[model samples]
Target: MSLIYVLDILGTFAFAISGALVASDKKFDLFGVLIIAFVTAVGGGMLRDVLINAHPINWIGDLNYLFVIFTAVVFTFLFKSKIAHLSKTMFLFDTVGISVFTLLGLEKGLSYDLHPIIALIMGMISAVFGGVLRDVLTNKIPLIFQKEIYASACLAGGITYLILNHFHIPENIIFIISASIIIIIRVIAVKFELELPKIKDDLFTKK
Candidate 1:
């Protein structure tokens, strides 16, 4: 199997765990947890595929993808209590979730002969849309709207990938560098409580 495929699976697994954690936190039952995990794992990729006209989509034909989601959901649910420790050490599952997906989405776009700008948008969408969907379903403010440098990290990763690609970097190396960039940015943002500036509603308030 190619590294990209592995990264894609990892992204799906991480995202599934993230979703399962959220659902579990919300007191969702097993079925609801599984549903959230599956959708959060595949939703962004599905959107990206549709936009890029990737016929049949990625998970539609692959039973393994479902298997991965199922495994992730089960494991995450079983180990929910212990996962807090994991997050304390490595980047949070949500952060890892976005990092890998951003690279895969950008690569997929490049494979489709898309422009770099569009590819960057695809990367951001692929990284964050699933989380947004999950948050919306759970009645929480989505991370992107909360101004914590979520989607911006994805964008930065995509830009990094494009720059490396422009310099004729190898694919595997490019993936590592770009993915690391996103993860580091997310880690620092969360660690330092960094957030992008929000526009004031007063700007549009009627006098």
Candidate 2:
């Protein structure tokens, strides 16, 4: 397989594992865990494809995505005990997955001649909406709505990729740099507990 395909599979598996972990935290059963894993793996790609009119979306075109997600669910279940103790490590994995997926999504959007701004938005959605869906289904507020720098990191990566691409940088380099930027940003933010300002309810109170 090509390196791109390998990276894609890795990203998919990472996403699935992250989703499965969340489901486990919520005390979901095997079926629910698998469902979350599958959605987290492909939900963003499906949405991007639909918006770009790239119909017969990616997972539908290739069964390997499903296989990867299932494998991830199984692996996560088997390693649940070990994984539960590694919350920081899991967050790192999740950060990497989101970064890689965001770059892939932006590449796909650019390939379809989408505007750069739209492509950046698509990339953020592709990286994050799956996690949002997973959290919502499990009755938790989505991370994007929380003070975490989640989507912002994805957006920063996406914009960096677009800027680099505009300068005629090679695709491989663009992917690496963009993904690295996201991973670094996420790690630093988590390490320092850095977050955007929370909107205070008092600011919106009627006089």
The parts of candidate 1 lying over 4 Å away from their true place are 89-94, 201-207
Give the per-residue Cα lDDT of candidate 2 at 114: 84
Candidate 2: residue 205 lDDT (0-100): 89
Best by lDDT: 2
* True-vs-predicted CA distance for residue 108, candidate 2, Å: 0.9
Query: After aligning candidate 1 to the native by TM-score, how far in Å is the CA of 140 from where it should be?
Result: 2.3
Model 1 residue pairs with clashes = none
On residues 1-207, what C-alpha lDDT tens digit does candidate 1 reach at each position?
286677677778888888898899899999999988888888888899999999788789688889999998888867878887887532554566688888888888889999989988888878888888889888898867977888888888889999999999888898888888998998888789898886766677877
| Cα lDDT listed for each candidate | 0.84, 0.85
Q: Which candidate's TM-score is highest? A: 2
Backbone clashes in each candidate structure, one number apiece? 0, 0
**How far off is residue 43 in model 2, in Å?**
1.1
**Model 2: residues with Cα > 4 Å off, grouped in runs:** 86-89, 201-207
